[model samples]
Target: ICNTVYRRIPLRGVCTKCGGNLTLTVHERSIKKYLEISKMLTEKYDLPGYARQRIKLVEKSIESLFTNDKVKVTKLSDFL
Candidate 1:
């Protein structure tokens, strides 16, 4: 799914007119879809140190990519 959407995107960048946002969203979703399961499996099995580190690196990269750092709070009262 990610490959198909990625292929459709032009070399320059994502084009919003051609569902670029949707394409990127789908690609990210597909990439993260199996992340949890992979983590679980790694924990369940006695994988090598290198393998565990690789998964942790991937998780951190994905989180950094998808995380919004500049969120604005609209209403402090809402939280309380």
Candidate 2:
């Protein structure tokens, strides 16, 4: 499941189950925008709950980027 989610999140031009090709450029841009929004929120607000969720999401996005590049993470915990 981790591997599947890893692949789905980051890699561009991967094949879909229905034989279609998936691309990451658009998705990456979208995630980046969300990250920026999250960052801005963090800067402007003191809401711990909202900040925590955004932080987790940004971390996941970073993890996906690293995984997409075939970085050899020794353990899932390390990735986390």
TM-score for every candidate vs. truth?
A: 0.54, 0.38
lDDT of 2: 0.61
Off by over 4 Å in 2: 1-25, 65-67, 71-80
As a whole number from 0 to 100, the lDDT of residue 44 in candidate 1 is: 93
lDDT of 1 by residue, 1-80 (tens): 23344546566565545534334554678888789888888889978888899999999999888777897667889889
Q: lDDT for every model?
A: 0.74, 0.61
Q: Estimate the overall C-alpha local distance difference test score of candidate 1.
A: 0.74
Highest TM-score against the true fold, candidate:
1
TM-score of 2: 0.38
- Rate residue 29 of model 1 by lDDT: 84
